[model samples]
Target: MLNIADVLHRWCRAARPFALATVVDVTGSTPLPIGTSVAVDEDGNAVGSISGGCVEGAVYELCRQVLRDGGAPQRAWFGYSDDDAFAVGLTCGGELDVLVQRIDPIRHPHLTFAFAEVADGRPVGVAQVVDGPEDVVGAMLSIVDDRVHGNAGSGPSSRAVADQAHALLRSGRTARVAIGGQADDCPQSLTVLVHVHAARPRLLIFGAVDFAASLSQVGHFLGYRVTVCDARPVFATAVPYADEVVVDWPHRYLEHTEVDDRTAMCVLTHDAKFDIPLLRLALDLPVGYVGAMGSRRTHQERLRLLTEAGLTQDRLMRLRSPIGLDLGARTPEETAVSITAEIIAHTNLGTGLPLSSTSGPIHRPAVREGAVMK
Candidate 1:
């Protein structure tokens, strides 16, 4: 959804008729995770991709047919076909279940607002009816806080659906739920898909050096809301590499900024003058990662100074000094990769070992929950 927000915003506003096909469920390995979508216009132009590029041609045709025939909600499964001649299947050996629905803005008043919400990076969710009475098949509910827009059904059924959708929105996870009387009450229910449009995690880089630029670019590509903070106005002025370039003391900037469990802070200034105070506050915060770039001697010095400033061993332990995985990176770009790799590995709890050296599964197990059929 994040990847296709721009395109959705465009088509939804053009008032052009289109059909959206979403990956509601997946089995085994998949190139794109669930909740990913592709919208096909009346002319067969596509906005996003659900299966990387493997079966897009076939999916495009299916979407075109739906638009032409004005069909009911269609469920299409693409899998590994034993016969090589089969038209649409994952050659990579996985299975995907897609639910395609047509949304007419002329009929559904909230249709434009839903796409605009995602396009503007707002906190919003959509509860789409995939199965039930044919009339409710394409029904949508907008999730904002505890309230919902649009209709799911009449009386108790609508309230039940809205409550379940709000639960999923708060959790910021996608799920398929069947709602009838009360939330999660019975099998005599309507199947709905809830999608949460959460913002990407933040990566705050506290430097404006060559390495910082490279790291900023890599962080941006890694789907981070990257910001570069430096005390020197001259250094901060030219940082087109980050989402935001702030001219302020690293500690001051961090003190005023809001950080959450998903935020990662990197101290690349290397100088103790800037590093000491910043690390003092960063290590004590609830951020997911706090790493500093310096030599072994510098790291030891930093630890001694931080300890003298009343930082406990527990707080110091949170710091990832001499940052990045042991990739022997020398160039700025390579160092950026190494740093981002370490960040990813830390977040995923990965060992950071080469696949050839490790026997564990290359991809982590999907903690998928929701959108289950009874």
Candidate 2:
């Protein structure tokens, strides 16, 4: 799976076989998201996780069974059991449907290519036949930039599935797609699990200060490609946590770089000279998050300057000046937590409130319907 692509690539390069158990579907409050996977090598060594700590032992045994069965794929269901406390299930009362399948270069050449694509930071979608006809079950195809490698089934069905997989890949979502017997030359209905491995989103931190360093670490932990950019070379040289460090004017660097809706830009440089031009560009861009660090008075002054720079009120509303939630944070680490929390909340449509006070489902629905496995 893409979650452990690096490890899988190593095993694959060595011609080692492994069984991978991936979370394909979920109902209710699950601990892990869809596409989360755990892989077990031929020697029973495991990597990655699904469900944090709960239900791992059961999944591990399932992986071992798949490996021993000569790569036969299996489906497993885990849910909370009130009737039997000792049952192997999730304690959080959520139901998980996992698909355990074996992978090797011989039978699954597409997977080896998919793993390599993921390792190289390329966007790819792997579509596997989770449930279908006998011969087609466990068949897979990898789609990269509209080009599909390998086969899911027959010619017509594979093309149909690849078309749908391409759409999901563009959206950067993992989902289960159902194809009925409507297509030409395809009579059997099939369920395809399209696992999207989009390239890591950018977390552009525009100041190499201490807070930026701490935030860069958090960004990496969140699976982002972090870059620390500042005009001052002295401050930018030693940001150890960032994936890339750029010593250039923040606004200039941002203008020449690529960004998308998933990119998050943080303006930690509170000085007017740096904040004005950089924010004027950042807020206008269609980035996911644009937060600036400053005090109330500083925020007011920055807003006044931006307003004079001809930024519309709607554009100004997109800026999260005086960034981060009200966490009463003092240390840089705590502040980083607060800022990343705000970014997640904004992206996920979460209310920044205590879960204990909320009475509804803890996990919100996917931003796009059917974008996530549920």
Candidate 3:
């Protein structure tokens, strides 16, 4: 888990040239996501992992050649196929498509800036090489301060791809795109990897109750930047949250904080006075998940209040009141599990039905067998 700053610092100090490999796209039970990257030094040192050790060895060899010869970038596809299997295929019966590139770090000052912004908790993006020269293969496009920095080569086509990459950055998606080509062109032939570096999930707990504490802990475990915001100064102190506590009015905090599709706001306040305004703010934003804790009657009351406040049925439908899924959870810990499970299910668009009832794919197809490319 090398921080972006540390990655940049190490890259800056390296005197020799090296190639970087990134998992710009994965399919069918693959090990990594679109932005997963690994930096390979000339000596065969690897910083990050793209496929949980599945494809690193093969990618390292590709990187070594890129370092030796500044060649055009190439896309490498690996999958577990009993018939047409490549040497780099996943052993766990998954598929991964990796883009590998040799980058001239000296020429790309903006790459440093992009990683720095990520390290400092600012929103930036990396343009992963989806289609490009082997030397600059799978290398990400570095976007900082609303401008594209690394294009491998600057052209109108490159700029057009960069614009799309920037848009993807705003949406917090990491994937490849085909652009600026005729309709007859192959869909997968287009070259661009748009990888956005977004802020980690933010968990804003409105209440300082014990349930809120357990939820915050769970949120932290799930890689969220947990912030326990409460009006109670004593309860919202650094003891519970340590480095991530916020002592403020929940409504005011929601007003000032940036809530995007990557954000998850939980209204555990369970009090109409404190919860209403905050919930209203969340409903107005494009936040991914909004959860409110209460019983069935409590939710009905809150709905009445929200309707009185002119909240529409469409917006009200977005609220997951009574919080988590129905696991008959009674204790706070069980309730926390239920709530987090609901959040994960919502995030992944999971059906909540037993897997035993399902007959098809286990994981998302986008992660396996090049389905996303189609």
Candidate 4:
């Protein structure tokens, strides 16, 4: 999803009337996932996307209606049917439930903080009373306590909603959740959409070679904070693909940096001075993926060197030497894709086979935390 901060803040600052639309829920396959949002202003200016193409036009009209009528918050369902009369529905045979509301920035002060949370790369949960009384229809707030943006509702309902929102945020997902429980009987069901925006993962490419250059671009496109580090100051002066270019020893740069389970380490530096020391440090770290680029003989020699340096077989196994899948890649760009594909597969726990050859769902749920840093 595009940054909501830019669109909403601009409109708010301009004092122009606008409507905010969000995909609250989705079932089966969908063009856009739930929690995707778009801001439609009074003059029909739109930013961000909900359903790429399928239900966008219909959603646009809903936004316009809210703008024309002045603050009419409503939930809409766009789906497919065999015997259909409506001209507007998803042709992909999926269902989408969207929540559209006229949000006055001047009136709803909390929305600014929610947009800021997304901009700052801090995770925030948005809990809205989707199905509720008229007074609380468009009531929504960011699930952050220290911030001025607080809960939307009052009483038992608000407490239950906060707990549910926190549980969903910890998993780092966006979905529709039901709150409110019973004491003696079947309690009321309040629907809240929990949208969590975690910071993008980091990808460190330790080389200024052709493959590293190409991989840097691909990593940025895949939503990673890309950094290209090399020992040669001239070679590492500037890499257009990477977000940052650092001229330092690969191992030294890594040691000074903060790497977590979401960090991806790509060691493209074939020289032993850079590769051996960096790979030794990388293999033991808790990173999402550790890769090194080299020929068969080069990799074997590197393995021997690593073993002499006190790396065990189990620790050495974590290194994907001669990195990337066997795609018969000839060019540096193609090799970059091969390596990127392998990293994505490792992160998602996929077999890296064609969807047609797979039996189960093509898009498996986010089963674990980015594939356990393995």
Candidate 5:
């Protein structure tokens, strides 16, 4: 799995065989999403987790069994059991369909290539036949951009599945795709799980202040490629946590940089001279998050300036002024946590309310069906 690509790459390079249990499907409430995986090596060492803790023990043993037998991939299901409290199931009242398979360079060279691509920070996707005829089961196809590698099968059905996988990969989704039940090209039905390992999203912080440094560290921990930018070279060079430090005007830098819907832009330069021009452009961009740090008074003044600068109410509404959730944070580190929390809440469509006050599934369906884009 991409979550433990480093571990998989290490084991692969050492010529170690391991069993991987991947969550291919789920029904009802579940803690972890589909595509979550758990891997176990021959020596009983393990990496990654399918469920947070509920079904891991059962999945671990399943991996061990697959490793011992070295057989075809096995599909196991786990669901809540009201009749038996001691049952190995999800207490949260959900069902998980996991596919456990033995992985080695000799048999699954495609997986080895996928793991290596993920480790090298290249975008790649692996489409595995989770449900199909016995001969097609566990077959995998790897896709990197337009090029397709490996083989799901040796027919038109494989080509059809690969086409779908390529589309899903471009959209950055890890989803189950079904094909070939009644089609003339293929009679047997096949269900493939397309798992994507895209590049990390960008988190651009414009300020180079202490708060920016702290936020940069948190953003990196959260798996974003963090960039700290400032007009002053002295401050920009001091931010040790950012992946890239740029000494340039915030607005100018943003104007030339690439951004997408998954990108998050934080304007920590509370000053009007920097915040005004930078935010004017940031608010118009279709980014995942655009938050500015300032006081209530500063927020009102900033809004007035933006309005005067021709930004409409709709664009202005997108700005999170006096940025960050209300955590009563005063220190830079605490403020960073608060800001990151708000960014996650916004990206995930969370209510920003305490979990105790809410009901229903704790982990909602992602904006994109299989993977959380932002």
Candidate 6:
């Protein structure tokens, strides 16, 4: 996958005309989530994709027009499931809102900065309220990487919105927020979507085993910033982990590293000495899912060791020891699948039921601000 930031940088540096299509919103069972982007040059060649080959042709045609017009911003709506009056729609029966904008780094300094931050591997958000097709004109809610911009408000209201947005950026969420309405009068009823495009999901593999190698390959396939950290330099070498290897003390490694709600940490070390200390350290970080591999007996003994180490009930409850789901996985490949499945399940908060068993919409709700409403 071509990093969207790199695409923007090339377009800017070459001074070539290209249209950028961003999936600003998705109403129903969309193939990709909001904030997905694609850059199409004047030619049909494109980098990145927003949908599952559903509306690319249409968006490409629109890009041609955008390029010809010096890359003017255009708005195109695709609704496969909804009864929208749009000539080009999604084939998978879903709704998608594509924001096709022309890139001019000179005109938009913030956008250029956003591209730089994203290319630098820091998760960021770009929030804006659109009033028209050409509207770069709203409360310019800019967040470079994870930092918030503009006035979020005052007292509880400001802090609340700002905190929520930072949290969402950490989780890589893109959705609208209805802000302003606390005991004071601010900008009430404004539609502001926190455009989080840069934050990369983390893949922390704790072991230096052969299974870890396969897991690293799959983790990169899913676009996670993979990090295979192990104490043994002999095992966790550049050959095994390639570009994604970290040779450090497992427990101490986490102390210097940052892990947020979008982060996933897996304990493949299997040894109690390595697993216990690292798992305990991971519990303190705001990581979303913590997976530890071992047998049932190992988990029991690990828990006892944790208790003896002065770990409290609340902290112990945060671990997903024995890791992965109960997929009856026996082989390394099957075990990898089980581990990945558990990560996905935890990411989506899945109930482990078939889609047919659920009556509600299969899509995740567009993340509205990050912090709790209450």
Best by TM-score: 5
* Residue lDDT tens for model 3, 214-291: 787777887678777888898776634423777888999888886666577778878988888888777877777888
Tens digits of lDDT, candidate 4, 144-216: 5433265556666666767767776665566677666574331455777766666677899999987887898
335: Cα error in model 3, Å:
3.5
Kindly indicate the candidate among 2 and 5 with the higher TM-score.
5
Give TM-scores for every candidate, taking all chains together and pairing residue i with residue i. 0.82, 0.86, 0.81, 0.79, 0.91, 0.73
- What local lDDT score does residue 337 receive in model 2, on the 0 to 100 scale? 98
Give the per-residue lDDT digits (tens) of candidate 5, residues 242-356.
8899999999999999887778889998999999999999888878889999999999999999999999998988888889999999999999999999888888888899999
Q: Over the stretch 73-125, how does candidate 1's per-residue lDDT look in tens digits?
A: 78899988877766678876788888887766676656577668777777678
Question: Global CA lDDT of candidate 1, please?
Answer: 0.79
Q: What digit string (tens of lDDT, one per residue) describes model 2 on residues 1-374?
A: 68898898888888899988988888998887777899999899999999888889999998998888874689899988878778787888788889898887777776777889899989999988888887787788999767899988888888878887899898777888898598575667889888888878889999888898899999999889999999998888867668899999999998999887888889998989999999999888878889999999999999999999999998999888799999999999999999999888888877899999887667554453211111
Model 2 TM-score, 2 decimals = 0.86
Q: Which stretches of candidate 5 lie over 4 Å from their true place?
A: 180-188, 368-374
* lDDT measured at residue 301 in model 2 versus the true structure, 0 to 100: 95
Name model 2 segments beyond 4 Å from true: 41-43, 67-72, 144-146, 184-188, 232-236, 363-374
Task: Count the clashes in each prediction.
Answer: 3, 0, 16, 0, 0, 4
Q: Write the per-residue lDDT of candidate 6 for residues 1-374, one digit (tens) a residue.
A: 12377777767666665777777677867777766778888666788888878788888888778877853467789886456545567766678887776655555465666666767776666665433223332323457645655543334444555565676565666665666554554333344556666556678888788788777777787777788889999998863433478889899888898776777888988898898888777776677778888889989999898888878888788788788888888877788888888777766666666788887666665433211111
Ranking, lDDT, top scorer first: 5, 2, 1, 4, 3, 6
lDDT (CA) per prediction: 0.79, 0.86, 0.70, 0.77, 0.86, 0.69
| lDDT agreement of model 2 with the native | 0.86
